[model samples]
Target chain A: MDFDAIISNLPLYLKGLWVTLQLVIMALAAGFVLAVPVALAAASRNLLVAIIPKAFIYFFRGTPLLVQMFMIYHGFAQFDALRESFLWLVFREAYWCALIAFSLNTAAYTAEILRGAIEQTSFGEVEAAKACGMSKPTIYRRIVLPSSFRRALPAYGNEVIFMLHGSALAGVITIVDLFGAAKIVNSRHFVPFESFITAGVFYLCVTFFLVWLFKRLEHHWNAYLRPRETIAVPTIAATAAD
Target chain B: MRKLVTAVVTAVTVALVSTSVIAGEWKKIRIGVEGAYPPFSSITADGKLVGFDIDIANALCAELGAECELVPQDWDGIIPALLAKKYDAIIASMSITEERKKKVAFTNKYYNTPAKFVRRKGSGIEISMEGLKGKTVGVQRATTHDNFITGEFGEAVDIKRYATQDEAYLDAVAGRLDLLLADSVAMDDGFLKTDQGKDFEFVGPGYSEVKYFGEGAGIAVRKEDQDLVDMLNKAIDAIRANGTYEKINSNYFEFDVYGG
Candidate 1:
């Protein structure tokens, strides 16, 4: 209700906003890169290659990300040797631990989405490319990958939004994302509604911007599907006449 | 076809009605706790819930002639969950702050501890604000410790907030955090017992800021449950007057760690 109090905390909220954005951007980029290979393996004909990635996806997806984060951040530290080892440097910071957990979890879901989209690509297009004497690698590169990416775009957009929301969990492990910042404010001010509502608005703005961007990308990719205006007008007239 | 649809709908309705009736029958009084604060409440190695809060809660329930069940809830969601009737009350060492008082009623303070800072041994760090400048300090999220650290250190210190006290302690032990700020009793239990904790030490004199820290740890109840709060306060006072409070206190903490 106190607009001024909420306005005063804008700087802290902005700092949190920055951290949330960084986490989402970094996690999405790294997760996408990791997902491409996993998706490829999942779609591969070889059982061994396919099974390994499938298991990785299954384990990460089956367990909650909070548990996965704890396992990576705390459970991994339980071993004395791990603490004394060189890898301790990476696992020591909460930021990297959170980044790792988010990336792995996102990778699992992204791989599944990409795999679904890749499989949904038209078989006729591949046959046509083969008839043109295109090699297997060339056909995949020129046709399959592009079509799959286009088909996967919408799902990938959803994934991006999910990752943004997931970044809120960074606060659990000690990273001061937006939710973390709001929590600090809430604890200090004892105004949960004000702090949380401010944080929620920030998230809404970020998600809204992302949705708009994705919609634009979807329109751009589907430009070919837009019927020529002249033909569309005649077809509509003919249908009306009929 | 219509008769089949009607029969199916009747069956579904009967099933749902029975389920609700069964759910409405109270078997136990569910108690929600953060489970991250040690000595007060924490998860044991065997995945069983144990600690001072658990013992006190069980004792209180026994005194009230009611069955008790423990529910692990995140600190941030604890109060909301209680309001939503996810649990009957909160026994999570939740301080009775004035702001929170607006939402829920609380029994009298049961336990209290001064806030302190813990840095690695041989780190040569003091508790002074200047010493903590640009240093990463860890504190449990949504706690008075978190509020105090941020207030005292401000932008000078990079405060890392954690959902649980254990997580912050782990980070401190792993050297990710320069210092750990928490309730003195909690730090005493966490750092004084563990092998890694042996290398950590509390710095300077512990203190409390009443404005932000609130009163002390107390059982949180619904605002409408004034009768329940009265019963609890009476039991709490009785325990404190007798040797019961001291007995429980000595089991987990040294000296008298009560009052704000």
Candidate 2:
């Protein structure tokens, strides 16, 4: 309702938007890259290869993102050994702590999605690739991975938006993300409704944009699965064939 | 005529007595207290609320012969909750600030303490602007200490505000903050004396400027509840006079917290 407050604080929100975009984009990119190997290992029949990734995924997925963030930012800081370790360089900064937490958490969720898609790869598709004398690596690189990505696209899109929302927790750790900006504005002006609604609108816009982006990606990648278009041939075409 | 006069007098007396009963008696007082600020108010592991504030509240209620109910509320929402009638008054160590006076009224301060900055014992961080430049200072969000630091040293320091004083202490212990500003008594009793705070010591002079820290911690009531405010003020005076306040103050602190 306070248009003046929202307008005056526009720059703050924009700065926060930048931080949020950076966190979400970096987290998603990092998560996707990490997810590929983990998903492959998780889909593997070899217990030794699958067990580690499975445990990693289970631990990250089972706990709340807030707890994970706190564990990294506050919990790890409790140990003097960690504080003295070289890893403290990364763990000390709240921004990096939030980034690492978001990346790991999203990586787990994305891996699970990809693992499901990989397992659901049609038996015939692998058989056909094998019959064509394709090696395992070539089959995976040329056929399995691409198809799995297409199948996982919708679910992965959901994960991207969820990560965006989850990145709000970064603010709690002291990073000035979008929600943090709103909190600062609210605390200063005591306008919780105006401040939070502004943040909510920003989130809604990003969510809608993500939805549109995913829709286009899905359409482009699943083009082969769409019903084939019918064509009418002129009588001259039949004559030409003769 | 005499009989009619007597009947009217009796009716008027009955009405006056009933109205006084309804308006004057604060029989059950629901006092709001933040259970996060330890040594002042905190919830124990078993969930019982106990601290200086709790004891003081109970003593005040007992002095007034009213049954008291302690409602634990988050510090951030304490004022709004009071306005919404979540409780009759707040016994939390709320500074008697000018900004708070616009909405809620305050009883006379029961205890007064100055704010101070704390840091790692050997950090040698000066309290000056140049000295604290680029240093991260932690404070409880929305507190007078937050206001003072943000207004005075915000440009010089990276001010990190937490929802509770304990969170700020946690961050301070974690070495995330170079300085911590809060009530001297609170930081002394709540954080500094604890094992996690062994390395930290009070760094700067105590800040008790009336403009920033206000007149000290007072009971807050709704503006409309002037009667309740007056009653609580009288109770505060009675307790202080009866040595009840001294007993509670000594239980949590070593020195006189009711500042001159």
Candidate 3:
């Protein structure tokens, strides 16, 4: 009911939203880069290459992200060597620690999502690539990876939102993301409703934006699934209206 | 038609429960305590909540002639939990601030302590803005200390806020923080005197400014529970007048912690 409180705290909410966006974008990019190799290894024929990535996936996916963050941020200091080493500079900062934790955690989930999408690819497309004298790596580069990415769009879109929400936990380590700003506001005003509701709106807007974005991407990439009339030139206005 | 019947029954049940609650008098009370702030209220290794705050809660309950049920709640959620009726009162060492007064009522403080900085034995960290410039200072987030540091020295210092005082202490031990800011007694008895905090000493001067530190930590209850607040204040006065408060004080500190 306190509209003044919401209006006055708009800047704080914006700052928090920006931090959350930064964390999610950076984490998603880093996770995607790391996940490709991990997905490849997990889908490999070799046992040794597959087991290590599998174990990593299980470890990160099985444990909670908060616990992993604490281990990297607080647990590493227990070692004398680590404390004295150059790595301490990176490990000493809560921001870097949170970034590392998010990147590693998201990589696991992303790898699994990619792996599932990759498995869904038809054998015939791979056979066609083979018939053209394309190497395994060439087939993966030209056909498997691109198609799987398109197939994985829906789930990956959900994960982006997941990472956004997860970024709220970064406030626990002192990085003032969206939830952290709300916490500060509530602390000062003791009005949880006003501050948290404002933050909830920010989250809602971000999520809606992301959902709308991926819908357009899905429309463009999965043209075969769309009507032939809309295939030649996908109009932004149509997608936006939809 | 069936949905309407179900809704009618639910509404009737809810009304009955509300009427009984409003008409009833206070009997047994549930008290929420943060079982993490040591010497005030913390869980022992055996899972017992024992500390100065817990003792005061028990004494107040005895004075009021009511059975007390203690609920351990995390510090961050303590206020929300109280609002949600998870407990009737919060006996945690929550500082009595003007901001907090809007949400909850408080009894007279059972104890008062200043905030202080803890650092390495020879760290020579400055407590002033100029001295603390660019230095990392750790504090438990959402606390009066966090607010004070951020509001007062935020431009000069790199403030690292943790979820708990213990986490700040851990970071200080690991050399990740140049200084740790928290309640003087909590740092003294809870960490500074302990083995984990042996390398550290209470550095710089203690701070008890009303603006930042607020009033001393007090028991908080819903504003609607004014009667409970009055009852607690009377109980606090009775114990302090008698020898009970002093006995408990001695068990924790050598001096009168109330600063009376």
User: What lDDT does each candidate get?
Assistant: 0.83, 0.91, 0.87
After superposition, the stretches of candidate 2 with alpha carbons farther than 4 Å from their true spots are A1-10, A188-191, A228-242, B1-24
Docking class of 2: acceptable
For the candidates in turn, chain A alone yields TM-scores of 0.92, 0.94, 0.91
Best by DockQ: 3
lDDT of 1 by residue, A53-99 (tens): 99999998899988998898888877779889999989987788899
Better of 1 and 2 by DockQ: 1
Candidate 2 i-RMS: 2.0
DockQ, all models: 0.29, 0.27, 0.41
lDDT tens digits by residue: candidate 3, B1-260: 99999999999999999867753455688999988888888889999999999999998888888889999987777887898899999998888888788789998887888899888988887677788999999998778998888888989988877767877888888888998889999889999888998899887788888887777988999989898888889989999998899999999998888964
Poorest 10 consecutive residues of model 1 chain A by lDDT? A225-234
**Could you arrange the candidates by TM-score from highest to lowest?**
2, 3, 1
Error of 1 at B200 (Å): 2.5
Local accuracy of candidate 2 as per-residue lDDT tens digits, A45-110? 999999999999999999999999999998999899999998988987899999999999999999
Sorted on lDDT, highest at the top, how do the candidates line up?
2, 3, 1
Q: Which ranges of candidate 1 are over 4 A from the true structure?
A: A1-8, A37-64, A80-82, A115-137, A182-204, A231-242, B1-35, B42-74, B78-111, B209-238
Interface RMSD of each: 3.2, 2.0, 2.0
Which candidate do you rate higher for TM-score, 2 or 3?
2
User: Cα-based RMSD of the predictions, in order?
Assistant: 7.4, 6.4, 6.1
* TM-score to true structure, per model: 0.75, 0.89, 0.88
